[model samples]
Target: MALGGNPIFNGKNFRGATQAPPVPQAYGQNQYGQNSYGQGGYGQTPVMDAPGWAAQQNMTQDQLQQMYNRPAAGPAETGRMTYDDVIVRTAACLGAVMAGAAVTLFVSMPLASMLMIVGALGGFVLALVNTFKKQPSPALILAYAGLEGLFLGGLTRILDGMFPGVGLQAVIGTLSVFAVTLLLFRSGKVRATPKAMRFFMIAMIGYAVFALVNMVMVWTGAVQSPFGLSTSIQIFGIPLGVFIGILAIGLAAFSLIMDFTSIEAGVRAGAPERFSWTAAFGLTVTLVWLYVEIIRLLSILRGEE
Candidate 1:
């Protein structure tokens, strides 16, 4: 998905799913007369439309009353997305990730490395497939999570082995950031405003460019440091990696905000229930990115120590 915003919410689907439905018109005095405001609509007379008193028509008095008093149908009944649906689907995806992560954690080092490569390659491919797909597929989304878990597990194992406790620290950091960001969003202390979004986009582009350059430098042996220019270069005596890592983490957190916004819009617009899978997938992707940045940052900082 487009990292700036959840890529899952893009194109026409994005436009439609996030749109607010038109407000329902209140039935007051109109060309249809005063009874239009009453039960059974404008078609019935005032006496007949009155609750409990409307006994004489095709419907029983109790039936009419029940119909009038029936609570409005929710997203479940209307075949739309809801907070509950998103939560359940997101949980399922994360569960798959954890299960897959456990598999790698218990494997031999060589086997884990192999699985990591496989997972990285497989996850990247599947991520593209799922993001561009018009309709959300439960199978693909879950597969992406599992594959990503494999990769994460392997990476974490390798890093934690070299530097004890870094992995745990990173996990704690990730959770802390997530919890804080979510709390801020819920409390309305943080929001994805247009100005913030514009900044995010510009910063993301610069970060992506830097990441690509570093990858190239590392691959080509231009820099021997683990993180290439990021570690080799320094600004004000602090490794450039530190600043970049913090910035990356910030961007990832803001990305989570965008995901939350999109999901909220989707629910408001009465998006299809199955799209909850889409929401889940988007959230999973963002969380993974956040975790990776956090762990890498921890490793870099610990290395300095």
Candidate 2:
């Protein structure tokens, strides 16, 4: 007896609680010249050989059709992240940043400064939010872009006010570095290997610590200059800040490489389509960092002169 009833009640098996029909086989041809077999005339037609369990089941046309039409069930689909997606998202972020900048330039400078501060704080918070979210949200990512835009705009205006044309120079510098890094990455000349990644992590930690210390010094009036000790110290008659800025820029560029690598891995691992937001967020972060570093370096150079 099967769990539910007798297994052989209807000439079927009651191996357990459920009963299963006997396997079918190709029967003799009918008047239509089609082979007929079991209750549904299933398995009457020869099918390609199936695996052991499937072969023993002798499936019906309806069953097979149902299986074919069913939604695929498995881990999320992933593939190599395409250049097109990255390019499109990056362009969108840049557009937002430019728009934010334009507002700061045309509007009150004080308001722009406030916005920049707000953006800096807001963007930092949201960056962490999006990074840890199990699933990426497009809205959050775009919001982050907007916030960072405000920050960049304010920063640019401040720097440009101090050093005429510095904004344009920084923009050009950022674009040049991005283009060069992208070309190198595409050409496989530079890669984010494990060793490089380890170094990046260590350098990033050190940089973050230094930035915090510098900011504290500025707030406490320990360093009277606009950029704290960065503007005061000199090496080879050049401001130490300039050298540090260059190194910082290099780190930002390498961070872009890591973002690219992660995107590639996500795509190849069949990550969900929505995860594209993560890629966009990462790129935005790197670009913002790059732009800030370039602008600061320009400011430091101008201050020296």
Candidate 3:
């Protein structure tokens, strides 16, 4: 496991995954006394006219019955990760997010905002905890999702209150972008290449720096605009937030690709089944980021209008 490859697959927890044990090669050449053609190949071969292939191969009747009765091994049975595990876990995380969001969306603004702050702080802590932990904790991942949901709900509420209908627009925008990105990735139009990943890392750092500065500016009352410099500053008469938002959306999309790459690698490498939680967590984090960026962009646009 290594960072920058995909945050989800990084760290000690995933390092254990290696190539799967080789499947037993079928008893190749010829089984028992089976001949090259119709004729018997050799006298030393097991008798072909035996009661069963097992008997011919020297396996006892009990062994034959046990083998026949053995249940087929699945991902769960084999302790290997699978697409279904990822889907179910990711759905669970998103469901938790929605549950938390529902609570904040209907609450008073002050209370909602307070909860939002709590969630943001808690989510950040848990995110770091889950990310760096040698083991993936489902509880922590779900907690992160719930907290993010609260933060998103409060933020969306505030923005929607300021500019009516923007919330709906943002939701649509987020979903549209997500669907398009997924389609592109599945269709092989986009990928997490080394060159693209390098660009993603650089852009992520730059965007993070700007976000930190913007938050400080807003907090210190250095920028009166609701979106801080993103709104106060303009490029060609359009707020800087617009360009930044598009860039952020692209980054989020690329992040999804990275997540996909990690999941694919894990499956191919036969990573442990529990690692699906890691996949789910990564997807949840990326989706939340994407939604926040889309909502903020919509809010900025609406505010300008």
Model 1 score (lDDT): 0.81
Candidate 1 residue lDDT tens string, 59-123: 66675565555455456755678999999999999998888788998889999999999988999
Model 2, 132-243: lDDT tens digits are 6765677787888888888999998888888899999999999899889888878888888767767777787888888898899999999998898787777888887887
Cand. 3 Cα-lDDT: 0.80
The residue-by-residue lDDT of candidate 3 on 77-108, one tens digit each, is 56678989999999999999999889997788
Candidates sorted by TM-score, descending order? 1, 3, 2
**Best of the candidates, lDDT:** 1
Candidate 1 has its poorest 10 consecutive residues by lDDT at: 26-35
Model 1 segments more than 4 A misplaced: 1-4, 12-60
RMSD of 1: 5.6
Supply the global lDDT for candidate 2: 0.70
Q: Provide the clashing-pair count of each candidate structure.
A: 2, 6, 0
Best by TM-score: 1
What's the lDDT for residue 284 in model 1? 93
Better of 2 and 3 by lDDT: 3
- Whichever of 1 and 3 has more TM-score, that candidate is 1
Worst 10 residues of 3 by lDDT: 25-34
